[model samples]
Target: MPPPRQSIAHLAERQFGVVTTGQLLTLGVEPSWIKRQVRHGPWNRLHRGVLVVHSGPVEWRTHAQAALLHAGRGAVLSHRAAGYQHGFLDSPPRVVDVSVPHARHVAGSPGVVLHRRRHLGAEGWAHLVNRLPTTCRPDTVLDLLTLARSDDDVISLLCAAVRARTLPAEIRDAVMRSPRMAHRRLVLEILEDVEGGAESALERRYRRDVERRHRLPRAQRQVQHRLGDGRRVRADAVYDGLGVRVELDGEVAHPGGRTDQDTWRDNAVLLERGDVTLRYRWRHVRVTPCSTAAQVVAALRSRGWRGTPRPCSADCPVT
Candidate 1:
């Protein structure tokens, strides 16, 4: 009989390196066969005893895959890693994070980030379609909220999560049940603050903490309000009560193709309204929504509107 086919060729069909000894045993390949294959350069050792066949470049599986291999039987992928796996983050994270039982610290490998917590309650873990483990939406959000430093960071993340719809209503409700009820409330407030009000990123940020928080008179967003020159200009937001027209100047909005004409048209609108327009960029709108809102509120007050500066804080009463 032909010398048993080279062990290296046999395992390559699966397309991932990093296999356990038990897997080899199940392949009906004897222990002596494995040793002989290793000694004869038919396989390459990746981790301690974790073997890779020698026919191709060493393949790097996802960190989740590596973690599952390391944790062996009990661990599940979770936290930021699971978020990435579940399409929570707008972009993939640079690191691999995994969650294993508190029973013991699993051995580490290069680029494998392990998080050990006793809180892997049943809801925290889920199988990723028979692949590496992952965390459900609620647990992932909870993990992020627990670790993030500022309310702003949490809000930013929450906006993206809600937009992605990875955070279902049930997951959001579960967050309220956690010990951080106050923070959870704040997150929900932030989520409500941003949803469906504005179309662009900059406009959403402004509408959430600035327009709504300050109780500035409402504006017709993306509406075509015409100027005397018969030029029709669609302002980002137009508050007729304050005669204050707010425009979120973004590259995408005024992409240089027709922005100059649009700006000239906007100037026409301002002149018709007797110079009562306030234009803002992303930086001013995002960093200091309160201050930006204050400016807009003051301008609105000038136009015979009455209001006080309303704190955007969750505890603040309606002004």
Candidate 2:
């Protein structure tokens, strides 16, 4: 029989000190040796057959490794767990998410969510990230899309995932792959806007809720202006000839001294052309869109814009 160090110990080192009873048996380990380790206090049982080699604290990675072991062959980290793994999500999920083949049955345990998917494998849909199986970048993004609670969540999720790793085309292809996915059309629409320069969710909301819904004058997107220093800058939304520019700020708008750079561009527009700029954040654009539309209308009118702001609906706050 092979020694424990040569077989089970090596696997544990690679898998965050986690090993399965099935794996240990395959490596020629006796059954009582596993039970004795658990009973002796050097090891702990995390699930039916999954064991952690150390008695120390169990971290997130260790929990994830244990969950995968319990799930057995052809199971992968998916949904929120995969999103965290792919860098698409901002934080780690409290519950570990795993997907197993629909035909394969695995009983669930506490703190682990098992997703039974029709086509589950390490094929194109999944990838090995840091020795753990996770859904591919695009598939992870898609899974989060279906799981989003609101339209804003969908937009934020798409923008975040797109900026983090996967290309816009990859997202679209994943959409095509899942024909009957929940919120498929909504995802496709948001994907289109993201590809068309709606880089942030706040910007997309401004276009849909404040501008289009209120019937505000069409604003050209990403209009370029050459500064006196010969450098070029692009404004988010511009009303050409009227000299009105609108800027949209998401939660993390100005980072790494971008505020100073933005001020310089605003000064350039104000000094060179005597134009006015309006800036809005998530609250102005998302929470109170009609009020935001009114403010935008007043700014455009002050700039000699003749068009009148139209109320989006009968109950719209805009007059």
Candidate 3:
């Protein structure tokens, strides 16, 4: 006889329509009935002993459920999978990443990446999303940082998480507490930059390439200024001594009319106050950073800055 549909449905509902064969057996379901359901009924097998309770399309949630079930007990969604669950990732993960105890040996599959961890049992690191166990937002950030391929990738993810308010205070605590994490020094430096008002990848790039790399003096970031009409504007980076302000346009696409007008108005006010502003785009900072730094150096020089620009690398265009 088939297992009671009502009981199975209740369990599947909580698990995104997925269930392990072990769960069914524990619920008094016969082993033969479980195989029969997959053989002839609406049930679809996702992994070894893991089945989707319905015949519908396998969505992201179903994949997550299957991965967790296949990893056995104490496995939680992690890395890019957890980033998606925390609403930081733009799309559903292509590969579901699940974390298991360091001592547990789980067979890996094409669609699932299993991570073995010795410290995953700590409190406040795991939470539930869609009834699936996942790393908390802070932990997810740290985990994703490890998987980042480049410094740009790390900055992009960190800025996006911070902008979306998904990154929590505990992220810093986690980073500082974990002495074994790879890229710990770089991660700490990026966190400090973000906390110090480098809120976008573009802004961070400008700081790294245009200012620091070129040996330009440190400028106050996100400096607030008030217009004659009481409108407040924040400059991306401001050199108070040189009266030179730098604006970073990070958007790849052109701005709308209103944004353009606001920029024009803000520029007019700043110009009236004798403050010189220079604007740089995303490509300017990332692609031809040396040339971009030269321009900034020129602007500062025009404003009576006596410091000379220095080359960051041997091939650096800036002299």
Q: Report the alpha-carbon TM-score of model 2 versus the true structure.
A: 0.85
- In order, the Cα lDDT scores of the candidates are 0.65, 0.85, 0.84
TM-score of 1: 0.63
C-alpha TM-score for every candidate: 0.63, 0.85, 0.80
- Candidate 1 error regions (>4 Å): 1-17, 28-47, 51-61, 117-125, 180-182, 194-215, 218-281, 288-319
**Model 1 clash tally?**
0
Candidate order by TM-score, decreasing, is 2, 3, 1
Estimate, for each residue in 78-101, the C-alpha lDDT of model 3 and write its tens digit. Answer: 999998887778789889999999
Candidate maximizing lDDT: 2
- RMSD for each of the candidates: 7.0, 3.1, 3.7
Q: Count the backbone clashes (under 3 Å) in each candidate.
A: 0, 0, 0
lDDT string for model 1 (1-319, tens) is 2233455345544435555566767666678877776788667655555666664665334334645676666677676777766666655566667787787677877656787877664653576623556777667777777767776567655655665565446556777678554477777665554553444567766776687767666677777766766767777787765677887775445555346775686668767866466878767777777778777877777787776667777644334
State the lDDT of candidate 2 residue by residue for 10-32, as single tens digits: 89989999998888888888998
Q: What does the lDDT read for residue 71 in candidate 2? A: 92
Q: Which ten residues in a row have the lowest lDDT in candidate 2?
A: 249-258
